[model samples]
Target: MYSTIFSHVGKYKKEAYLSPLTIVGEVLMEVLIPMVMGLIIDHGIRKGNIGYVAGMGGLMAVMSVCSLCFGALAARFSAVAAMGFAKNLRSALFRKVQGFSFANVDKFSTASLTTRLTTDVTNVQNAFMMFIRMAFRSPIMLVCATIMAVRQNRRLSVVFLFAIPVLAFAVFFIISKAHPRFEKMLKKYDEMNGKIQENLVGIRVVKAFAREEDEKKSFGENTNSVRLAQFAAEKLVVMNMPIMQLVMYASITAILYFGGHMAVNGNIETGELSSFIMYVSQILMSLMMLSMLFIMFVISRASLQRIYEVLAEEPTITAPEGAGARARDGSVRFENVSFSYYDDMGNLALDHIDLDIHSGETIGIIGGTGSSKTSLVQLIPRLYDATEGKVFVGGHDVREYSLDTLRSQVAMVLQKNVLFSGTIRDNLRWGDENATDEEIIEACRSACAHDFIMSFPKGYDTDLGQGGVNVSGGQKQRLCIARALLKRPRIIILDDSTSAVDTATDSSIRKAFREKLADTTTIIIAQRITSVMDADRIIVMDGGRITDIGTHRELMQSSEIYREVYDSQQKGDDE
Candidate 1:
């Protein structure tokens, strides 16, 4: 865990090293104070030297103050370093996730990713701070105190030998029981986080259905699981506290009795015995800090394993070696392509169906649910690999182009619209950082989003809630379309993008795109028949195969699937 955290300290190497150095310096000062005290007791006070005692006492006080100064600074440095490391770690993880293909993400759910980014990172940060503060503190103090105690009186130091083993066993026992519990606790915490994410995201459904009580019960179940795991782990820790106290008390009692025997029998000095008791206190307290380190080790070990899981995973779809050349033409072709998910091999997503979409031409895709409409379009962006065949963009295999270059030329508005919490202008700028105000307005106008956006008091600068929850479904869709328009990519994929917009608005958006974006290749995947009725060409898909291909009127006459869909939608409109 320590090594993994060390690796994550990239770009913060200066702070990471300096933070620990300051902490150790502070610990050294603290350890010095006690040694000075032992010296003062044995030399200054024993010889009845008042000046020596006062001078030593003043020096010790100065050392204490120095320790405080170093400690305060180290704490500030440590906190700053920890936060910096965590921020970098989160960004790194998010980038890693972005590079991953859909298949890579399929291995874990959204909830698990959330846990890795949030709870897991927090665990590492906390463990890092604790390790920096306590890791060296206890060992240095313990070793120094032990040497001083033994030096004070050899026989009295024997107490430490017995006390040490007892403390070690107390730590080992709790750690063994607590390690698995902490793992379980983290899992439960993920469940709790997942429950909250689900409920908050679907709160409208919960309310509309009037199932608040049911939702509460679901939340309570997840929360209870977390509570139980935490309680079990803490119980073991709490139990160890009492056991450690018993051992410390017993050691103290033995030390007092035996040290008195040493002083009375002329084997040890009175002031020396005082130092032994203090040394004994340091030893026992040191045990407590060491135990905490053990628990932290358990937590960090688990978190490190999780972090390693992501780092070690190889993204399945990586560009081939020396695959740097890119073409300006955005033509896409699928040659004898076949693909399937990991678990369900028999359930092929796309099979041996060839497709060629010309550059600067509009291609509309129509399909039923699970007809591979989105899957086929996602291939243009190389979000996944064809399981058996090849996907070519720009007259070369997608794997031939650099990943960044290939993706840069393609703009895909997902079926599920998602927006970050930012102003309309900010979101639009994500598509094109150098986009001017006029360009942004032009993109919004083309997406049919300009009118509604201008209606708001703040217009494009208005604050949006997370995922654009403040906006209506149709508004979010239009904003997403505008964002894609701002990108000005060679290829634009509308994956059921205008579903939320009314038919008239959707038509206006298509007309605007047809006029302004004639040079760009467009792939329109829609559920509604009317949505694709005016496209230059339409491909009807059924069960992952291209069943029919032609213009809307041609397919409507020749394709039974298309005819049934048109009739069904026409009847629904009449009703």
Candidate 2:
């Protein structure tokens, strides 16, 4: 775990090393100050030697300044190192997540990943800063101060030996109990963030249904769970300071009592006794710092594990070695292709599907809900690989081609349209980064989105709010269609992408596809019979199987499922 996490401390190695080394200098100065004070008290003040007192006092002032400077430098370096480490770690994690297939993303929820990238990384960053500074300083200070005290008078230093074990035990016990609670608290944080995301995304729906109070109650419950877990973990950590103080005061009292008697009996000098007391404080304070560092480590251990899990995950979908670089054409073939989200044949989403689609062929697929309409098209782009059989695009197995090459030729407008927070022109540029304004306008016209866009004050430059919240559903769908059209892909799959538009506009968009994209393979997945009536061929799907395949006239006479759906739709339109 240490090696995995510290590997991201790439460019910050200089600051990482410098922080601890400067801290060592600071600790050395701190340990030496008490010794100089002892010299001033014994050889300078007691003997009425003004020159010696003045000289030692000057040395003490210089050491104090150096200690301060070292401490400031350590803080600067450690902060830089910790921040840089976190930046690199976050970048690596994001890159890994981007590489994950849809199946891999399903294993980890969006909310959980968000929490790990943010709160978990922040926790580890803070712990690393503390480790470089206090973790290094405390142990060295403890050992050095103990040695100095033992050298001054070995008998008086025995008091620290007894205090150390008791304090260490208390710290260990608290940390062991608190670690699991912090882990639980982080999970609760994920839950809370999930609730907040859902509530915000569906705020309009919640208000429309008058379910605001229910949402509030649910959010409150999540927050309360997080609060309780945090309280439990912190309650244990809060005990560290008081226990440290108790051990500290008890050791100081024992030192003064026993050493005063030794001084009176001429066994230890007053100056040496004073130095021993200072060393005792230093030793106990170092223990306190160690306990704090241990507590931080205990809290950050959970975060480290979460981050490591992300870094270690290999993307389930990756190009093979020496994979083909490009696709030859838009033709797609599913040779006994079967797919299941769970990778179990019993739960197959597309069962043993076999079909051949030629380049520039406009195919229509009409299916009821749960018939896996979206699942079928998703395979063409290699979004999710077929569980059992081959999915070929351009006569090459999709796996044989690099992902960038295969996906760039296959553009899809999914059932749920998504748009980022950017200007309309900026969003459209995602399809073709260097597309000219005339080309963008032409694509929008084909998608039936050009007129609506022109109505807006900023036209193409209008900003679409996050997820395109500012636009109506139909308008958003049209914009998404425009973005995909701009790609000018060989194969464009519109999976129920026109559901939000009226029939007239949908028909016009289909006409535009036929006239403008004569050479592009167009696959339309629709629920309405009219949407697919004019296609070269229409596929009727039921229960994850292709029940019938034929043209509109042939299916109307031969396929009962297609005839029934078309008749019902016609009857509904008459009503």
Candidate 3:
């Protein structure tokens, strides 16, 4: 997991390596400064040798300046390396998600992915920054300071052996207790973010239903939960500092008491005893740095694992090697097909089904909710692989064609009409980026969207706010249809795409499909009988299986489900 995540430090290898090298220079200078100060005190000040004092003082000044420069360079390099690494990691994650099948996305969920991309990546980046600097400097400083301290006064240095273990045990205890709590906190973050996203997306609904206070109360509860989780995790982490400070002060006090007595007895010089005290502080400070680094690791380890989970996830669907590109025709055939989102036959969403659709045929499907009409069309583009049996697009099995090749030829306007935050022209260009203005206008005309679009001040250039919030529901549906029409695809599936529009506009769209898309196969999934009554063939579905297939008039006489639906609509129209 560490190898996979850290491998994203791609082009910043130079900075990543250089940062620690500079940090080593900084540590070396820092270690030498106290030794120089001792020489100034013992040889220059104590002996009244002013020249020796002046020379050594100059050297210490130079060392301090060099240490500052090295510290600054290390900071710059580490920042660049960490930020660059995070950029690559986030890009890789997004690209991986783009390749994931619907089943794979459903497995992890959108909210969890968002957390990994933003907050989790940020955490890993921070840890990497601390790791590069402290990981090298702390241990190097600790060893060098300890050696120097022992050389000055071995008896005084024994204090560290005792102090070190105390700090080590404290860090270990905090890390062991805090890791699971941090993991729980991150889960809470996911839940809070999910609630916020859901509420923002449905803000209009909440307002229309006069549920603003309810939503506010729910959101407040979610944020409070996140706060409590964070507090629980941080409570243990905060223990690290007080314990470290206690150890440091005690170590310092023991060093001063023993070194002062040694100096009084002439066992250690005044300069040596002063320098020994400095070394003890350095030794204790290094241990504290290591403890802090450990705490950082404990916090980021959970984030790292979460990121690795995404990085390691194999996309459930992948294009077969040596896959074909072009479809033979728009013809699609399903033979003994069954599917379950969970890949269990017992829990099938689409039961064993057999059907064939000829190229360029207009087939209309009518079903109540949960009938899996959307599931049936999703297979044509290989959005999901059938759990059992074969789904063929053109002639070969759907899996035989590359996903891009199959999907390019199949334009699916899903049940949800989604338009991005861009100009109408930009949205339409998704169908055919190179589509000419004339072609754009024609597609809109075919979808009966041109008149309403031209009514806007900027016409095609008018910006559609996020999710096309600037437009009415019916307008959004029409714009989406126009965008799909611009694809000039071999197969087009409209899964309740026109439900927002009035019946007159719906009728016009169906007429336009007949006149303009004559050579293209069209499948319309709808609740209204009028939407499919005029089709060459109509499929009536119940549960997961297709119960009947016939023309409107033929189904009225033969299929009880169809006749009941048609009669109900007829009675409603008369009323």
Candidate 4:
């Protein structure tokens, strides 16, 4: 996990190296300051050697300035390195998500992925910053301070033997107890973020239903759950400070008492005893810093695991080697295809299905809500691979072509129309980034979206707020259709895209397709019989299997299901 995450340090690796180098210099200078002060006390103050004291004080002042400079440099290097690492890691995670197939995305829900990208990355970044600075400094300070303390008097240094064990055990115990709690706390954060995303995305529906009180109650519960989890984890971590301080002070007191006697007996000088106490303080303070590093490591370990889950996940779908062939034509063939979102053969969303669609053929598919109409079409673009059989597009298996090469030739306007927060021109440009203004207008006209678009004050330049909230449902659908038209793909699959438009407008769009897209394979999935009645071939599907395939007149005479649907719609139209 560390290897994968730290690889993102990239160009800032120089700064990462420099941070520890500077920290080492700072620690060395800090260790020498106390020794120099001891000289000022022993030789200069006691013996009245003012010249020696003045010289040592000035040296100490120089060392202090150097230490400050080193510390400041270390801080800057670590900050840059940490921030760069975080930026790279977050970008890598987002790119990975973009490459994930539908199944991969469904496995780790959107909310969980969002949490890993933001909160978990930040946690790891902070841990990294602290690790680089303290991990080296603390141990170096401990070793140097211990050697100095022992030189002054080995007997008093023995107090560290007892104090070190107590502090070590405390750190070990706290880390072991707190780690699992931190893992649980991060999971709580995922849950809370999921709730917030859901509520905000559907804020309109919540208000329309007058469920404000219920949503508030639910949000409060989620927040309270997070607070409780955080408190539980922190409750154990907070024990580190008091335990460390207790051990530190007790060691100091033991040194002060025993060394005072030694000084009175003239076995140890007063200056040496003072320096020894200072070394003891430095030693204990370094140990305290080490303990804090361990605590931070424990917390970041959980985030590390979460982040690695995203980083290590291999994309379920990828272009095969030497697979750059584009589709030859719009022809699509499904041979014994079956699919399951869970990849379980027992639970199929698209059952064993065999169908053939020729280039430029107009095919209409009608199915009930769970008939997997969308599932069958999604296979053409390789959005989700067929679980059982080959889905052939342009005379080759869909998987034989690179994803970009295949999907670029297939324009799919999905059931749930989506328009991003951008100007109308910007949204349309997604289909063809270099589309000229005339091409944009022409596609919109064919989709019957040109009138409404031009009706706006800025025309194509009008900003469509988030999710196209400024437009009605029908307008959003038409705009999405226009966007797809801009692709000028060989195959265009409209999955109930015109459900929001009036029948006359829908007919106008279909007529425009016939006139402008005569050579393009048009697949329309619709509920209204009138939408598909004029198609060259109509498919009836039920229970993940095709029940019938024929032209409207042929189905009306032979297929009872088709006949009943037409009669019910015809009666309704008459009434």
Best by TM-score: 3
Clashing pairs in 1: none
lDDT of 4 by residue, 1-575 (tens): 88998899899999999999999999999999989999999999999999999999999999999999999999999999999999999999999899999888888898899999999999999999999999998999999999999998998888988998899999999998999999999888989999999998888899999999999999999999999999999999999999999998998888889988999999998888988898999999999999999999999999999888988998878879999677888999999999999889999998999999999999999988899999999989988989999998888888899988899889999999999999999999999999999999999999999999889999999999998989998999999999999999999999999999999999999999999999999999999989999999999999999999999999999888889889998999999
| Candidate 1 wrong stretches, greater than 4 Å | 1-4, 11-53
Question: 2-70 in candidate 2: lDDT tens per residue?
Answer: 898899999999999999999999999999999999999999999999999999999999999999999
Please give the range of 10 consecutive residues that has the lowest summed lDDT in model 4: 318-327
Model 4, stretches more than 4 Å misplaced?
571-575
lDDT of each: 0.85, 0.93, 0.92, 0.93
Per-residue accuracy of model 1 over 1-575 as CA lDDT, tens digit each: 35644677777667667777877778777666766887798899889889999999999999988888888887887787788888888887898898888888888667778888888888888888777667867787778777777776787778778888888888888878887888888788777887888889889999999999998998888888888998988888787778878888999999999888878998877777787788888878888788778878776777777876776778998988888868669788889998887635587998787988899888889889999988888878888878878888888888898888888889999999999988989988989999999999999999999999999999999988788888999999999999998888999999999999899999999999889999899989998988888877899999999999999889978999999998999999999
The per-prediction tally of clashing pairs is 0, 0, 0, 0
Q: How many backbone clashes does candidate 1 have?
A: 0
TM-score of each model, in listed order: 0.92, 0.97, 0.99, 0.98
Q: Give one digit per residue, the lDDT tens place, for model 3 in 42-102.
A: 9999999988988999999999999999999999999999999999999999998998999
Give residue 157's lDDT in candidate 1 (0 to 100).
77
True-vs-predicted CA distance for residue 89, candidate 3, Å = 0.5
Work out candidate 1's RMSD over C-alphas.
2.6
